[model samples]
Target: MEKPLMIALDFPDLDQVRQFLAQFEQTDQLTVKIGMELFYHYGPAVVTTIKQADCDIFLDLKLFDIPHTVEKAMEQLGALGVDYVTVHTLGGFQMLQAAKKGLSDGAKRAGLPKPHLLGVTELTSISEQVLKEQQNCRLDMNNQVVSLAKLAKDSGCDGVITSALELSDLVKSVGTDFEYVVPGIRMHQDAAGDQNRVATPKDARKDGASAIVVGRPITQSNDPEHTYQRYLKSWTLK
Candidate 1:
């Protein structure tokens, strides 16, 4: 079975992605995330190139925009044949609905496979202090996260992007229909760096996250494969 983990190939260049992939075998069953840094650099063609090598792709553009614009963009992204895509839930109800509709429509028009559309709540980099002080949002961190997850689900998203710290409350509040794809995951031994709401792979799985996104913990390691395996093994344990 494929591991319930998607490695973020966050390289700014396609060459780096290629070099990393070359280290693994064809039948390795890895799902790769092409986030903004890589996507902005390589574009949709990079998606096609990676899939041709037999890896499922998660296109994490984290798009946030007006309803009409975001909807239209999702139409194009759906046509690219990615397995999953994301938008910011903070964009409001209209944008989320438009995105859902647009992706569905795109699937019908082009006979393309519809990707699982996820809503990004707060970024893992954001802190409760920032929400209260900088953004003037009064909700506590956990409450704010649950509120957004609920909105994202009500808005027709199939899943959410959040840290594992908030996963339990989200699952309790919203039920299991919405998949939780937790990012900001730091391996137990890894540096926390800029991420604030981080979790180890085991914790994320225990909290019922459907998938976890790991970037620097693996990519920046001296042994990328070994680091990836550490995440894989952690998730695989019963």
Candidate 2:
């Protein structure tokens, strides 16, 4: 299967990553996602070690901050040579522009291919009510995602990280230019965990997700390799 499976390595310890990869031994078939937990522990060494193993990686730090700060951080992160990285769409236009500039300059300096910069629209864990009451946003769930997705594209992002539930609409809004990297994909029978919105792997593919970010479903399963392969087969099917 040629579908990209970004295994969300949300594990806190680097050893857990090593154990998981050792057990699976299918690095070529799957890309790794280094989120807050793993990156905080092993830092760039985690990205470096995974690259040395010949596995594509997504640095899922979801960078957010002032324009210069986020830009500076991206400059340093680009040195790791991962396949992709993320920034929050809520960071606004100038911030996103700064990030793009940083990535371009850093990649040129390091003589490596530029990483795909994705924007995180809204985490699937948060609901529309919270976004309205707490975050003080009046936009409904779908509109909220659409608004941020447009902002991401206008700000020069290659893609946006959204839940599968809104991916189809986001695709319609943004057309074919921007990529929709959907997360919060769970099997029909699996527990939804912290995710408030989700779709099954097959549903996500059917909804036009360019890539699916799966975490606990495969990582926490007893037979992760089989589970992973099942998803790969499912995504490959026409």
Positional deviation of residue 63's Cα in model 1 after best superposition, in angstroms: 1.6
Candidate 1: where are CA atoms >4 Å away? 1-3
Residues 1-238 of candidate 1: C-alpha lDDT, one tens digit per residue: 4335888887878888888888776524888898888778768889988988788889999889999999899888988888899999999999999999988887667788788999998889889889899979989888998999899999999999998999999989999777999998887779988999999889998888999999888888888888888888898787
Candidate 1 similarity to native, TM-score: 0.96
lDDT of 2 by residue, 1-238 (tens): 2358788987878777778888776576668888888788878888888886678889999999999999999898776798889999999999998998888778878999889999999999989889999999988989999999999899999999999888788878898777888888887788999999988778888888888888898889898898888877676577
- Note the Cα lDDT for every prediction shown: 0.87, 0.86
Lowest summed lDDT window (length 10), candidate 2: 1-10
Candidate 2 backbone clash number? 0
Clashing residue pairs in all predictions, respectively, total 0, 0
Q: How accurate is candidate 1 locally (lDDT)?
A: 0.87
Top lDDT model: 1
Per-candidate TM-score against the hidden true structure: 0.96, 0.96
Q: How many backbone clashes does candidate 1 have?
A: 0
